[model samples]
Target: MRFFKYILTLTLFLALTKGYGQDLDKVDRMLSNYPANPSSTEELANRIKNDFSNDLERVRAIYKWIALHVAYDTKALGKPQRVRFSYRTLAELEAKKKQFRKDLALQTLKKRKALCEGYSTLFQNLCQQMNIECEIVPGIARRLISEIDRQNLPSNHAWNAVKINGKWLLVDVTWAAGWVDYSKMKFHQEFSSAYFASDPNEFAMKHLPDDQKWLLTDNINSKAEFASQPIPYKYFLGKNIKLLSPQKGTINMLKSTGVQFNLQNVPADTEIAYHFKREKYGQKVKSFTKADTLSFKIYSELKGKDELVIYFNGEPALGYKVIVK
Candidate 1:
C-alpha cells in the first residue's frame, strides 16, 4: 500500500505540455535512468479501480501521499518568480542538464524536481488517463484577513479542484508539501491535509482558484464575481449577518418574516433563532422543544438591518435573510 500510495500520487500529477521552455534533455535522462512503472499506467489504473471501489478511500490515499511525499519550498515563499519549481521545471532543467532535448514525461520521472505547475499538470493528466475526473484550476491567490484592497504578492498559484462522488473538493498538494529550511537544503515531511476538502471560507484565506467555478460558494467573501470580474464582499456582510452567542444570558428566537429554518440543525442547549426580517412579515416565536425555549431571552431585536443574524454551534452556519430593512 505504501508503494501504491506513492505511485498513484505520482500518476495523478503526471502530465506534461508539449513545446519548448519545458526541460527536454532532463526528460531524456529521466527515461534512461528509471525503468517503467512496476505496473503499467493502464494496469495501475485498473488496480486502483479494484482497490478503491469507493471514491473517498481512493482520494484519501492520494491526499495522504501528496502531503507526505511532496516537500514545500520556503525559498519560494513569497517569491513570485519561479526561480525553482516541481516536476515541470525540473524536467526543463534536466533537459538543459542533458543539453536542450525535447522534453517528455519519462524524463520528468528521472529527477524529481517539479514546480507547482508540474505537480498539478501531472496530477491532471493522470486523472485524465485513468478516467478520474480532475482539473487544474488557476486563480488570484491571497490570504489577507481583514478588508484590504491589495497586497504586493504573486497572483499566480495553481492547485487542483477534484470531483469526488459529485462533490467538488479543494486540494493544494503544493501547500501540503513541506520542503527544506531556507538556509539549508533538506526535506521536511510534515504535510497538512487541511487543504484537502477545505471549506470555501477557509480556502479564500489562502488560494484563489483561477476558475471562479471551482469556488464552492457564491456566498463567500473576497470571492471573484460569478458572472464577470471579481466582487470582493464579506460573507458576513449584507444579509450575511452572524449571530453572537449571548455570553451573559440566552436569547430567544423571534420570527417577523416567514423564512424556512430547520431547528434541528440549530445548536442544541442554546437560545432561540428569530427571523426579524424576511420577505414577508408576521412571524412569531413558537417553542418547538421544552428545553430549547427555556432560559432564552428575546430582550432585543434587530430593526432596519439587512438580515437578522443568528448563531448556531458557535459558528455562522446559515444566513437567515436577504435584506432586513
Candidate 2:
C-alpha cells in the first residue's frame, strides 16, 4: 500500500505548448542554480523578471523555483486553525486581506514549507509582483479512491490560475512541490512540472473549483459528475496514457456483462495487471493493442463490492469502485 502511495505521487506533467513554442528546458536549466536566500518576494520576482523576457518563461521560472525549493508542511495537515478579521468598510476588508496574504507568503518563504494555501499564496504574490495576473482558486481535490462518491465534500484545496498572453492557465504548486508520505507523516521534495499551466480539462480530474468560472472551460462537469469521475493514480503523470472507456468512477457490475477498459497511447512494452480487493495475487490481464489504443476486460467471477485497481508495468495507474448486485 505504501508502495502504491509513493507511486501515486510520481505522476508526470505534460509540457504545455498550446500558445507559445518556447523551450522550457532552457528556462529550467538557466534557473537551475538560483540562490537559496531571497529577502522578499519582490527580490525573487525581480530576479525572475530580469532572467526571462517573456511572460511564459517568467511564470515558469516562478513555478519551477517554488516547486523545487518549497516543501509541503505535513505536520499542519488536519489541524484546523482560523484567524478572524474585523473590517466594517469594503476598503478596509480588502486592505486586511492583502496584508494577510503578504504575511502568509512571507511566513512560507521563511520556513520553506506550507500547505496548499501557503503555496498558492506565494505563487500568486510572486506573479503579481511580476505584473502577471494570478488568482488563488479554492476547490476540492480528490486523490484517494475512498473519496469517491463521498457526501457533502467541502473545498479542501487551493491552487492558482495565471494569465499568460490573455489566456488563463492552471497551476497547483502544492502538488507540484511533492506529496506526503502518510505512513511517516513526512514531506518529500520532488519537483514535477505537470501542474504548471496544465490543461483545464485534465486539471479538472483531481481539482473541482468551488467557482465554475475558474474552470476555464464551457464543458465543465457538475459537482456530482466531478465527484463520480475515475481515480487517476500517479502512474498517469508523465505518461501519455488516456482512459477511454468506463469513464465513470463507480461501475455497476450487475448491469454490465463485463468491465472493459480502453486506454490510448499505452507503450507497447508495457505489462498490464489487475486485482480485486479480496484477491491475494494480481492476475495478468492480456491486453489487445491496436495502434496506440489498448483494451482489456475484467470478468464478473470476482464479484461483490470491491475495488478494481489496474496497474501498468507493475505500478498502479487507475482505480475504480466495482459494485455487483
Candidate 3:
C-alpha cells in the first residue's frame, strides 16, 4: 500500500512539474557542454561574439558559461574587508578603486571562485567588453526560509540589469551558478536559468532592490509587499500553487492583515496547519471548508518581525513574514 501511494505521489509531482522539468533539462545540457576557463575573458567573449550575433543569444551563452564554470566563495560572505587603501591624492584613490575592480575580475576569472559581488562584477565587465550595457544592482536577498520573518537587515547580495535592444532585463549570475550549503559552509554547484531575465513580479518575491528603478517592470512591488510575500522558489512554480492574499508574496499588515492561498488536488483527509512565533498554532486556526482555498488571520502580540508558515501533512509548503510595528 505504501509503495502504491508513493507511485501515485510521484505521478502527481511529474504531472505538475512537466514543463519545469523540460526547462531544467535544457539548462542542464547547456551547462554540461560549457567549456572550462577559456584562457581569458576576451577570448571567451570573442568566441561567443563570433558564434552568436543576436544580443539575447550572446547573453544566454555568457550566462550559461559563467554559471557552470564559476563556484561561489563561501568564506567571504560576512568577513571583514581585506583591502584598505590610504591615498595621498584623489587621483591615487581613483586609480586604486579602478585597479581594485580589475583585481577582483582577474581573481574571479583565474581562480573561478567569487562571492555574489564578484559574480555580478565579472558579468558586468564581460558585458561591457562586448558593448552590452550592464549595471551591477546591489540589494537584499532572502537566502533562507527562516529569513522570511527577519527585519532591519542590511543589503547582502548583488545582481545585474542589462539593456537588451533598449529593454532592461534582470540577471543574477551568482544564483544561476549555484546555492550555498550552510551545514558544510560550501557551495553546491547547480544551474538555475530562472534567474536569467526573470519576470519582475516573480523576481521581486525574494529580491528587494535598493533602487526602485531597477524593479525593471511596470508593476512595481512596494517594500511592504515584498516583505509580506512568501519566498518565491522554483518549487512554487513546479508544484503549480496559486497564491491569493498577500499578493506577490507580500502582505500589508497596516491595512487588512489577512492571508490566503489556493492549492489544487489536496487530499480530503489532509488539514491545513500554521506556525507563528516559532510555535504551532494548533486548533486556534480553523480548517478550510473547501479543499482548494486556505485562509487565516494574523494575531500576534509580538511587535517586530514574525513568521507565518503554512504546512500540509507536517511539511511546510509556504511561508510569510509579518512586521507588527
Best candidate, lDDT-wise? Answer: 2
Please give the lDDT score at residue 79 for candidate 2: 88
Q: Which residue segments of model 1 deviate by more than 4 Å?
A: 1-46, 73-110, 143-152, 179-187, 221-325
Give model 2 RMSD, 1 decimal. Answer: 6.2
In model 3, the Cα lDDT at residue 221 comes to: 49
lDDT scores for all predictions? 0.43, 0.81, 0.68
lDDT of 2 at 97: 90
TM-score of 1: 0.45
Q: Tell me the deviation in Å of residue 20 in model 3.
A: 21
Please provide, for model 1 over 200-289, each residue's C-alpha lDDT reduced to its tens digit, 9 standing for 90 to 100.
534554555655677665443344221111222222212212222221111223436433333322334444343334335423344354
Residues 67-110 of candidate 3 have per-residue lDDT tens digits of: 88899988777787568899999999999987887678767888
Give the C-alpha miss distance for residue 101 in model 1, angstroms. 17
TM-scores, one per candidate: 0.45, 0.88, 0.68
Candidate 3 segments whose C-alpha is farther than 4 A from its true place: 1-31, 85-95, 218-222, 237-242, 246-260, 263-317, 321-325
Determine which window of 10 residues in candidate 1 has minimal summed lDDT: 225-234
